[model samples]
Target: MPDGCCSHCSDFGLVCTYVQPQRKRGPKNITIEELSKENASLKAENTSLKVKLLSLSLCSLCSRPLQSLSAQANSSSVFHRSTPESATTPPSPESPEEPPDEQDFTGDDLAERFGSFSIDSLKTKHFGSASTFALANNTLAMKENFLGRPLLIQSRRPLYWDVLPWEKEASNQGSDHVLKFPATDLIAALLDLYFTNVHPTIPILHRPSFERSVAEDLHWRDVEFGALVLSVLAIASRYSHDPRVFLDGEGSLSAGWKFAKQVLTIRQLSEPTIHKVQMYLLLTLYALGTSVPQLSWLFLGVGIRCLQQHGEFRRKPGAHKPAPEEEVWKRAFWSYVVLDRTNCVFLGRPMGLQVEDYDVDFPLEVDDEYWDWGFTQPLGKPSHMSYLVLHVRLCEILGGAMRRLYSSKKAKILMGWDGPEWEQHAVAELDSAMNDYVDSIPPHLRWDPQNLPQGTFFDQSAILHITYNHILIVIHRPYIQKNERPKGPVAFHLCTGGTRHHSHREYVVL
Candidate 1:
């Protein structure tokens, strides 16, 4: 801008031909040189502002929505430091070097902070939450909302909360009285279908324990556990070729809606237990499998909320179990987490639950049958739960990929990542982590296109490989140009993985 090309363009190797026009061409005390110097100064200021705007638009893909309300609350200091004179200075890398902590939402009370906004506040924080219909209708609004992602449970309209179908079904005696476990003859077939086709992939429920409970007919005596059984029946019904699965007047893919609906009707979330969590999680799977995906979110949301209540917030895993059902809850909770995160990425929705909110460790890798007994990790055989453990760990990485590649720009900026190079580093770190995870998988559960594992291992292998490829596809999805075909094998592997999901001839490819 020194009476010629501007400095802003020089950094980008471009020459700006912008020149300040003479105002009125009137002679004054200010010399022509002074006027030229002032115009050049203004040009430099504009360029600095443009660079900052460009970074905000391109560098931060998901940065806007998840921005910290607390940061906006404190941005007055940032804005105040920028005097009109500083506009002529070049943009500094240090400005975003030390951003406020995102989790600092816990400390700010909107009511107390009213003083700041009314006094020295620059009005930056007035409307992040409010703009998105996230008004603080309750006393715990600060704790209730994080950045802009909210807890799904709080999103329900409070006025109609009590009238939700689940609420009314609480007193309904429909499924509680009518639906008994299928006559003794049908139970075997449904349970077989569930363990054979479904349980391998989920592996959240303890098959031996569940079978023992059924043998004793104990599930029928307890309403909550009975709901759990019904959920299992609903999920397994999808895999059943038996006519009994549809004796209730529903057809294929909907063979067990009654049982699913019954579980929803009877299992009030008022008392959160491991059985309740498992019930909701299975219901979520059932909803998806039955092609009623609209219901999956509700089921998943309830399941996660219930899992949070079991004190997972404060526990850690050791060599052994915590209490009677502690290990069960832990396994089921992770399954719920995987489901929640998978849904977020697959559907492009925000995460329902962040990993930071809980502290429970992954379930021990021992087979569920031996989980009760000590270190009896099946000798010379594949542990039934090992595949599931690997899958959960893989999803943890997927969650990280989402945060790293797809989370708000504000998050990356706060963390001091300022350019596309940060993304490359993140991708490399994630790719390395993925490689280690694949390597760490036990031999039986590893992906083998030639000799896919059999029986229990089959479904687990299919899901693990499918999810592995799915994560690869997700991580590199941005690099795929708009409306263009992928130029690599990620898509091919995903296609093959889909074919491997089921061992049926149709799902098998030669």
Candidate 2:
């Protein structure tokens, strides 16, 4: 219409012929250019989607699957970006170590799987069972996640001093129904038994000072310290054969429970002290001895946190200069560690404390008398003190194994291992460590039925032997599922050896 293109053709009047010219096409390059623009847009959109997914994965609270995918994608990108020579070459053995990392808590793997944030996963995955999250946070908190991870028990807006129902039985000090104290004679007997039996194994308290406090009723003045005194009496009563040792028509079990309730009344006191720590430990021990392991394990966590608050693990160097208080605290901390590991093993739970977190020294192997005199006596290789030291060392190893092999994070990682060979290797290493621990025991402490020592020394020997076997069983238990161990050989050697070293009568007595 405008220039060369024909709109219409007409010949003059009649009999005119018309013809259409061949059409000319535009360049094909324009079409290809349009297609290229669309392709670039699509690639950009796909890349944005992938980036979004990776970001979401990074910020996710507990999306394990997404995190794994993101990690794989990232590692792949890193691998592809490497130079051809580096990609083809194997890692050199002489490459510098990465400054000896304390632990590997990479983004993909978090070590604290049972901290405050894990309550939901715990309830969902574990069902009705008590998970480590539940134990660390209160079991009540697990049920009601909104309650949050509070250390003390709560009743409405403020935490109540007395959390347990039984604690209400205690009356105001000046009230008509004031709580009564145990008789002096009963107190004397219980203290005697405690010093004679329990103190040898766990010498956290100084005997003379404790006795003075008890004689003067000094501890009874403060509610928290009073609870500690009551707990000690209650624990000591367990070793007593006489019913009269338990005051107010209470049995040994009831005595402990009554004191436990009193302790609960002061459980949430704003300040934590050494006496309070001791009270919690005694309560845990009492619970364990009575076969209430759940309660024991729970209280063990409480004690551990309390100890941490007191900075027992973070001792001030030279602050308590020349005083044996430092030594006492060290022993107390290790005592808690041993009890913590023991309870965890019994309950099949992860440990609340880790050895790497502690920076305290082990108590010196010396007589308790020397501690009272602010000096340490030279120790023989195979003395009672040596046995105590050896027990702590072995307990540390047991705790390490529990952490390495039984932790939630570690278990999750190992479940993805290529084969069962890794598990076998881990179990074998633990087995060797345990054997070495036993072999390190001095000759005199080692059990001998034929030439057994007199009194409690012989009893300690038998207990040690039984304890060693118990730990062995604990370490090797997972292997039972796959029939990786010959239970008969292990059982036969330990059981028969222990029996030969300590009579069947002794086993019954225990």
Candidate 3:
């Protein structure tokens, strides 16, 4: 009945039609009512997602007080959830809320409770957008520049002794006290001490000129006051075993204290003076050796600075001199050589003797004969005899002091030898040479100690003799057996002469 024609009707050759009732027409487009329902459902889902994100952002320990947004905000929660429309939108005043208490979380309280909010974190939070973080850090660093200030501040305790009272007083006192003394007078005094006390054996041709200048300058001081000041400061800062004395205490201004202070004050007067002051300070530090332990670092710093500055100065165009200034340069040249040699021995460096390092150069034509032989002569030479006697006495004193201060083995090693046996042999050789030289010298010349020639010729000749003796001994060292033939020709020659003098008598053993 529902089809267009039934099979029975088609067999009877009659057409039949059947039509089903037409279905009601569906809506052509989505209805506003249905869309409104869908939109409400979507809003509910979005709200649920936003609430989940807010909960995660509040942090796992949200029940506890929060210190930072970054520490709590979960990145995954934030990225997945759509931001609430009202999230970035400012709150209206109509929506009332309790005002946050300013004193609720002090820095200490936050640090104690949160434990993660460091000064750096707080700084980042406060200065997050600022580009001057580096400048601020540098300023903070400067405030902590004192030796142990940072450690003291961090630990909340005194790390070292307080500044001495006398030092504080000295600091307060104006340079007026120092300015009272003429700079020229101070310079003269230093020069006088240097000439009289140090390397006196070395001739100073400029002495007369220096003396005349000092006399003429009545107001002009001889020493570089600035240099003297620097020297004193360097010594006090580093070399004094008891710096508290000079620092601000009762021990201040003791003889040694005054001398050190005076020297330093004079040294600080100018840049040119600094070099001299530094040089002297370094020398004194080396001379003092480990006697002043605190000064070791100071000495190292000064020594390095001096070397660097001097090297740079030498590189300057006109710092180097020609043969014309030989006589004038000789004093400085020899002093530099002595200083370099002494430095090598004291500092255990491989530095050698040279004039260029001292900012001077000797003429090539000046015969080595004119150089002081006091440090170079062998004991048997007349020129070496007096010098050797002085050296032996000094060595004896040094040896005794060393033995008292160090282990016997250490003392021997320090004196440039491996063991006591070597030291003994060296001492004996020096003694024998001196004795031979003294004996060989006519009794009249040997007897007169006060009127000994103070000339450069004698000094230079003595140095040559010793240098030659040293060279010979070094060259023959491997070949010569202990107590066999002395390594040097000077000793052999002297012994041969002694044998000739007493042909019948057997040569006396040392």
Candidate 4:
């Protein structure tokens, strides 16, 4: 502290009084009002002496000790010093050359600053939060600032383990790929690649809704929204041109593992919503890319159950038109079904969601922009979402084939059938259904490999052919091997056309 600066002033900036008051008792016969006037005059006279405190600014005192400030200003003009010499006395400690905001301070002035700005709030919890991840990292889950205010923590965002390019050089090696443990700013690159490459295939997230949430900056406070954002970034990283994506050991497959792991770290119990379902599906896609189909299956199963719990699966009878928010859920539910049947056929596992259990309608053919409550015949006019609506319808046929050809013991008992005869009968029925579906596909999106679509409809056309062929292979899969057959010749004729394509190689590898 300065030699005579007020020791009681706060540690930052505060004006300290150096004036010593000189007062004496009044004589008898002096009225009480006259004594008050003389005392007030003396107080103003003492304030006339000019004094300046070193490095003191007015801004810090603006809010605190407001009484001292107002008193000096109000009394200065009305009550003046009695002597003529006091007229030339410049100013007191309360006044400075510049206001607090206008004054500028340098490093030298900051070196000896002091004030008390303690915030021992009655509401805040003093104890630290329990966190296994933070404990492992040797850090507090709830950190405090220099002022002793605890940071607000809302979500369990996964620690980032990605290192920057320059950072890798300083470390001399990135052999372990754990040079850093926090996320960097790669959101723009990842989002661009994801929406272009990944979203067209999955089409689970509604673009308009996602964009609006991002614009409103809701992800920082909303747990489910933040989780979905992380999941998307992870999926998009697989297609990013940025070299950092390839730092993980698994090549392009594990490129987004850091973000995927972050999503995994988050744990909270809340009502099921469309955002949670979309996040799960995105995580499932990332897991599938990273050669962890078991993790993919886990995420996929949870997503389907969440969709069911959200009540989008059961259609309301004579229902009123849905709000835009509600329409997104309706669309997300169909997306879950498509993914559900896809995993069911590829993994050769029974379905987690059943067909007959729910009677939900397919999503509109209208794009997200035009999809609104009370909109007329949503599926009547075709738009950007036409591809997804068609994909959902195609997956329904695939789900039916799973139930019929690949029957369960309970199903077999209920619909009694023998070996070869049942196989032949099932193939004929499914073949007819598939043929009808194939004929129903829009002419522009028809699955003809030789006459491929060129521009906007190109991806849509390409995926339909791949899905159609894959489902055909699954329909005749059981009868392909003669060894598995009991006694008779199996159906080799049905497999002739579907397995001839080269595009479905990706699906088979997956």
- Which candidate achieves the best lDDT against the true structure? 1
| TM-score per candidate | 0.60, 0.59, 0.30, 0.59
Clashes of 4: 7
lDDT of 1: 0.62
Tens digit of lDDT per residue, candidate 2, span 1-510?
Answer: 334333443223333233455689866766877999999999999988865653432212222111111212211010122222433332223221233222312222231332223221121121111333223223333333433332332223213322344433332232222234577897788889888888777666767667776777755565555677888877887788766655477655555455455555553433345666777888888887775668898888988887775557642332222245555556678888888878888888878888777656556666666655534565453345565677777787788667656667656476563345665676678778888888887767666657765565665666666667666665655444443356445645654554444455366446
Ranking by lDDT: 1, 4, 2, 3
User: Model 1 segments beyond 4 Å from truth?
Assistant: 1-178, 247-250, 267-269, 317-324, 415-418, 482-510
Clash list (residue pairs), candidate 4: 10-114, 10-115, 11-114, 11-115, 11-116, 12-114, 12-115
Better of 1 and 3 by TM-score: 1
Per-residue C-alpha lDDT of model 3 across residues 1-510, encoded as one tens digit per residue:
435767777778777654455589997688899899999999999988865653332221112232343333221110122223413433224322344333222222333333332232231121111224323333333333422243121221222323356654554443233422324544455455544433233332234433443466422243443333333333333323444324355443331344454543432322222234234544454335345534434444454443333232121122222221233333333333344433333443433322233232222222223233312334444442234333332333323222322335564467556654564465466546545544554432332335534443344334433432332233233333445444345446544554443332222210
Measured on C-alpha atoms, candidate 4 has an lDDT of 0.59
User: What TM-score would you give candidate 1 relative to the actual structure?
Assistant: 0.60
Clashing pairs in 2: none
Tens digits of per-residue lDDT for model 4, 1-510: 465555666454567675455569777788899999999998877655322221122233111210111111111011121333423443223222232221222211221121111211111111112322223112221122122442332322122223345644543331222212224357766776777776666677767667666656556656667778878887787777676765555566557777677678666444355677889988877777765686778899988877654546655332233445555667778777888888777777888878776666556555656644433445444465667877887888889888877878678668775466776777788888888888888877765547755554677777777888888877877776665543223446556666666346444323
RMSD of each: 17.6, 18.4, 30.9, 30.2
Model 1 Cα lDDT, one tens digit per residue, 421-445: 6866887898899889888988887
Give the Cα error of residue 171 in candidate 4, in Å.
42
